[model samples]
Target: MAGYATRVKADIARWREAGLIDPATAEALTRDVAANERASLSFGSILAMMAALLFGAAILIFVAANWEAIPRLARVVALFAVIAAGYVGGAVMKTRDHAAIGEALWIVAAAAFGGSIALIGQIYHLSGDEASALVTWCAGAALAAVALRSNPLTVAAVGIADAWLFLKGFDFFGRAEFLHFFIVMAIVLFAVSFWTRSQASRHLIILSVLFYLVLLVGDYDTLRIAVPLLIGSALLFAAAVFAGDPIDRILQLGGRLPLHALLGFLTGIAMIQFELADESTYASGFAVASIVALSGIVAAIMLAGRESRGLRWLAYAGFAFELAIIYSVTLQSMLDTAGFFLAAALLLGILALVIIRVEKRMRAAAHTGAAA
Candidate 1:
């Protein structure tokens, strides 16, 4: 708040000078600036959180120390007591408007629920699928997150739930391990993202969806994993590229899927590695490999790297690596190495020239439109 105060004040003064908003409206908006002055957590709140976490850990240690001496019923009572105390403390803090403490307590309660699940499962000698315990634990945490509107709890729940679903995806190869459950979790994560408007939750949900797409290859032959992933990423990239009123008018879905840009960018890089790693052969194996490498580099540079510098550099690296592989494997003469570098330099020069021309045309068009 202190850092941004001058800029905030300047912006408010500009708005006032421009007569974009009334004085009362400006004051109304600046109320949040006043709140920001107190946004830093006080020492007492920070100390309280640390002590609470240490105390919880101490109780867990005590449980392990006296596991045999404590009766089974007493052990259960103690576990539930910890949960009850956390929630009660959180509620009290919430009522008193010390939301930092309340949020921390909610996180503690949610974490303790995981321990309770494991302990209860062990105590009852639960014989059915071990996945049920994880799923149940996830559901409990998600319920708490939704009910309390806690962003941290929501993110934790999504992560834990995805872990459980991923385990299932690996454990069961048949239709039983289909990604439907992960899909459901993605939907739930999206709802939580919208409800809480947390950017972290949205990113987590997108990562889950990306991972789910990767998981789809578990059932396929090991040789062809990249095909579907690249296709899916291309679809996402296309959707993001063509977003807005036209697509919405046709599909009745509003707004862009901004996450697609990042997901597609990363998937493009992954596809390059997988395509290079594949040792499979075809009729024209060398030609096929060359085309795949070239296409991957071009696609990444032109589309995926349009917004991300990392992806652009990764594409350049991939192109150089492809040349190294070709030189080391197919043509291993000093002359061949020299030729490879020359060819690479020429290719890059051509690409740069094309891009420069395109940028110049775009700028000229922008100027023309402004004049019109």
Candidate 2:
């Protein structure tokens, strides 16, 4: 939203200079955009968040250093006191219109809540594993995020949840139940993201889901998991593209969902290619993988290149990687290598020509419509 406001203001300036609008209208538009722009983390807010984290860490360390000297009851009182102070201070700051500082303080409170969970568990010799602790911490962070609608806290919750899943990567084969719990947690986090409007949390959720799929492939039948992953990612990317406007209306994610989906799609493609390379069906798999990779990159560029710079860059990287893989896989035979490159060059050249013509026609149509 901040980027959008900045671009809108720049366009307004250009329009004013081009005599497309009067100075008064330009000023009014700029003011309206600025007024309506959503609040984003400024440099100070980021620094405040960092400082709050450090402060929370320091307090935890201090208590740990003096754990033996501090009585159990005092320790409990002190923990609650810090938590109360943080929330109270945050409320006061928000009432005073210091929203950035308020959010930082709220984050501090959330951190304290997590720390208290651990310290209290230790003090009482509570019976639980690291996974359970992480779940508890994530739940605390998520509650604070919901209560305050805090993006930072929501991000913290998702981060904690992903950390739990990452740890489970080491031992997920036996704990099949973890998959069900993880899916439920992911769904809850996704729901909380919509409530908090946390884009970072949404990105983390997508990445975590992909990570879980990778873990499944590592533990189970690779072909079964990889094939479904590829199909699912493709479907997800298609939906994100074709139904983008409606999704954005509901999720308010600013078209970022498609980029994340594309990442998953590319990852799935890479995974499948590796699996195929390990099998006896190498030749057919290579051909199919090359075609899919190249076509996916070209389609991405043609669909979203102008509107999304990130998508364009991702496509470029994917194209380079695809070519490199093709060269490496066919390195044994010089003829195969040369033929592959030649074919790829010809096909891409044809795609380039088609894309150029399509873009030209679209631009001409847009101009005609505007002129009318």
Candidate 3:
């Protein structure tokens, strides 16, 4: 069968080199043919499967025997024991390096066994306080991850532990006192972000910032506090814009700006709701002015950096937002919401024409330069 498969591959390669098949088509065919060969297992694969079965049975029996009196520490110890045994068995069987289907199955089995042990402990009320237990479990899992060089499991454990900590900290206490905790969490997340270069850690940091915003601004009736948040959000957006990579820049910038906008919009609505317009009007005006100013700054940066699409989007969003505010103010005076529809149509038409003319000029310049 191996010889037959090799011959088939050779024939395909010949056809590819002869220009009888496109490169992508040939590559796809090669992958399809290779897929079947990977399914075939050897003696080592069978041994790995048997070891996995025995390990699973041992874990099940251990859990069943201790079903009535297993303390949290005992359950933890038993789980570690199973993991250690599995690692040793895999190491001894020399099946660790096998790249076959059965090896993958056994690896999955090991992971499942570990996860099941943790779940069983939780089910039996042996996991203790959620925060403490999660921390302990995450620490253990992290150690195992380092030892086994398993990144996915490490990330999973870290995420679970962090989530548990956040929930525990946030629910019991409001954001005022929780500021310190969130800061610490952010530092930890930042460290993890750099260490693993994982997007999840970065996202966690962003979330921490959002939580900080809520804590700081949720109950405030003052602009002094809110203005700083708007500034911080603007700075964050600016940093994202100036980032080296386009995709990362967009993601980071996009994530923070919407929150900034939402917070600003909601704060405006809240001020209206509470009739705190006298104090809030100044803040609202300041925020709008700041947004307009920042929009131009971002546009300038984008244009200077030759980022056409990003600049265009930023400019359009800024324009639309300002126009919406104008329409809203007019609607309040006219008591006619239908007027906003006309204003929107006019704004959109003007924007569309401007964009088209700009694009046409750009194209014309490009063509002229090319001809030159």
Candidate 4:
């Protein structure tokens, strides 16, 4: 949005030169664009992310290797030292306007929290279960994110939460159920995303959820996983398409969740379709795929994609990919189903052209009426 607004500001300057607007209007436009630019992430955020990853890796490797010269207690104490130094340094840097460095240090502190959990657990010869330690680390990160409003820490919290669920969710409550933990962690991560108002954190949350679901697929059958994914896509598509204005307004910061969820779900379903390419299921899959694909494109354009460039492009790609899959599966059926797909694409193309023409005419009529 900042980039687009900046380009529009440049266009406005050109328009001012062309006498399309006055100097005052140009200045006002430039100010609005500048404000939009302020809404974007700073170079510091990117720098902090990079620094956190680099330093965090270094800390993990050192701890994971366990230098025998340093006693286990000393090693654990050193990790705690890092935690204190990082947080204290981050607080001082924050006060000194070194926000990026502060954030990076905070990330280091949070990561050290996790490392400390592991080291402390090992020192005590605690139960080998990983979930408890992960939860403790996640709790620390989550507390820091909320207290400091740190986006990177929120992402780390989400990652920790996802890992904990993936590793021990099945047997956590002695119930051996995965969905329970998934549901709980999802609520926490999503709440953090909104609270932080960080686009990167939100996308990281999506990536975490996608990772969990794909991992679930690894542990289960393709069709069983595909069924839930397809169902989820249908739900998102339906809500995106038919939801009222109030609901759409509430989804303003959802970014690409609706669109990408559809992508993940449909892609999984497509994989299943390829695996189970039988006559009965193939025909049904084709019908389901076409409907979901078309509906997804329309919903993306009208609801999610209108405001999001990434989602719009992803929708276009998904639609095109679905067409390819449909064509591939139908080619063996004597070109009958393939022909249907081609004809449908042709019809949709014609309809799009017609809509464009109508929109152009309507704009022209509006301009004429304004002049009159």
Candidate 5:
């Protein structure tokens, strides 16, 4: 028995020396491990669980009891009481290492309940404008998340607040100024996410960028210099694809599809203008071919990369735009138009077959690698 005890002690000593445990913590852990091996439950863990249950029940009872006549002061007091109870329960659970009962979950639930109570008060005639009421509710939620270190709820509150601001601003002013306000708000959210490490906030930023891109494209006809504007927009999309990660790649690629369609429409306009300006037929043909060739090359490169599904759609869009250009340049003569359509159909069919073959080979390689 003495020899067995000495061996166990030596093993523990080595663990401490290896920095797997701090000396003080190791002593406590060793005692806990021994107790656990004997199938014991710690008092602190039981107490923390009981506290959480009690507080949760208290919140329910308080709301139910005062559902009709809950005074403003009482609501505020209840909110603070819930927040304090949550912190204490969290601290107790942390000390006992009862991580299964998540602190963040309790905190967020409590905050949501408190916010609902406050919102109810507002609905019943506790004074505030729609903006102020929304801001207050979101602010309370944000505070709870920060206090409890809950990233998910913090992000949710941020998103709600941003949407509220955008809607209110648009309703008051109009769509024209809302675009600028949304961009500013998106930048602020992105900055906040960097510090908070909130994935939800990052997603909201992506959505904001997409919304702005759509707004810009819808208003493209307002621009006086259409060709230069189209080129700049295309360049911005290309830059976004190169500079952004996968998510940005998807957004930019989708945004660029509509731009391509717009390009085809604009191409018809340019043709009419050039014809009126007395441009030579050769010069016009060269210009049209150059635009089609450039767009097709870009699309092919994007499709080959296969980083996004949107890129594939954009590739198809480019092909459609190119066909439209070909039709316009040849529409004056029927035989030439038919020939151009036939050539395009053949090219698309071949491209589709090549893509399928490449995808099949990739799948086979992946399976082989996994098996190995």
Candidate 6:
């Protein structure tokens, strides 16, 4: 939004100079953009948020250190008091128009709610796993995010949701049942992100889902999972390319939907390649994966690179990663690898030429359409 505001302001200046818009109209437009654009967090706000977190951590540590000496009733009262103070203080700050500081305080209060849940449960000798406790904590954070309409709180809630999923076990494999719960929580967080306009939270949720997909393939290591992932990722990438605006409208993620979809597509390709390598067809499988990854990168550059620098950079990173993996996988056969790279390079060179021609035609067509 900050970037958008800057661009709009620049355009307004250009229009004023060209006499397309009067100076008065341009000034009004600039003021409107400034009024409506989402403000970025200042350095002070960042420090305040960090300070709140540190203070909350210190209070929690102090209380825990003297837990046995403190009366149980006093402990409960103290925890509730902390939570109330944070919320009430945040409300006051918000009323005074210190929104960033208010949101930071709200985050502190939400963190305190989670801590209180854990501390109270421990004090009462409640029976439950860490995952269950995290689930409760996540629920509290999520509720706070929705009620306060705080992007920072929404991000915190998303992090708690991820933490809940991670608490399942160290195995990082097949928890099909828990994955269902994780998906539900992710959906809730994603929806809350829309309400809070938290693009960061949405990114976290999507990345978490991608991580879960990786885990699924890692655990299953079969065609059933790998094939579906590949097909699904491809379809998703296609939709992101062709229907990006609609997806943006629905997801409200600006221009990042396609970038994320490209990542998921590459991940699916990697998953399939791993399956093939495990099946003892390493050379052929790795070659196919390289081609697919290279093609995806090229397509992204040709299709969306003009609009999204992030997407282009992600493609570049994917290309480097693909090269590194291929080199490592073929380390034992360096001679064969040399020849293979020559052949692959020639193939890709030809593909690049075709893509260049196609992109030129695409630009010409777009220019013609705009002129019309």
| Best candidate according to lDDT | 2
Candidate 4 vs. true structure, TM-score = 0.79
Clashes of 4: 0
Q: On a 0 to 1 TM-score scale, where does candidate 6 land against the true structure?
A: 0.89
Q: TM-score for each prediction?
A: 0.69, 0.90, 0.50, 0.79, 0.45, 0.89
Off by over 4 Å in 5: 1-66, 86-127, 139-149, 169-180, 212-372
What digit string (tens of lDDT, one per residue) describes model 3 on residues 1-372?
Answer: 355568879988999999999989989888888887534456876776566556566655655565457676666666656566655654454354543333333354455454555556656656455455455555555554445544333454456555654665566423234334545645554554444434554555555555555555544654555556556555544554455356455344333443343334333333332333233333455334534443443444333334344444545565555556544444444543355446445755676687679989999999999999
lDDT of each: 0.66, 0.82, 0.52, 0.72, 0.55, 0.80
| Candidate 6 per-residue C-alpha lDDT over 242-261 given as tens digits, one digit per residue, 9 for 90 to 100 | 88888888888777887888
Cα lDDT tens digits, model 1, 77-159, are 87888788788889798899988788778767766776676666667777755577667767887888777777667877887
Candidate 4 local lDDT, 131-189, one digit each (tens): 66777888899888888888778888888887776666454545355544665766786
Q: Using alpha carbons, what is the TM-score of model 5?
A: 0.45
Please give the lDDT score at residue 154 for candidate 1: 80
Count of backbone collisions within predicted model 3 = 0
Candidate 2 ranges with C-alpha deviation above 4 Å = 60-66, 172-178, 280-282, 364-372
lDDT of 2 by residue, 139-238 (tens): 9889988988888889989988888888777774345554547888999999999889888788788789888888778767766877777777677667
> Which candidate comes out best when scored by TM-score?
2
Q: Clashing pairs in model 1?
A: none
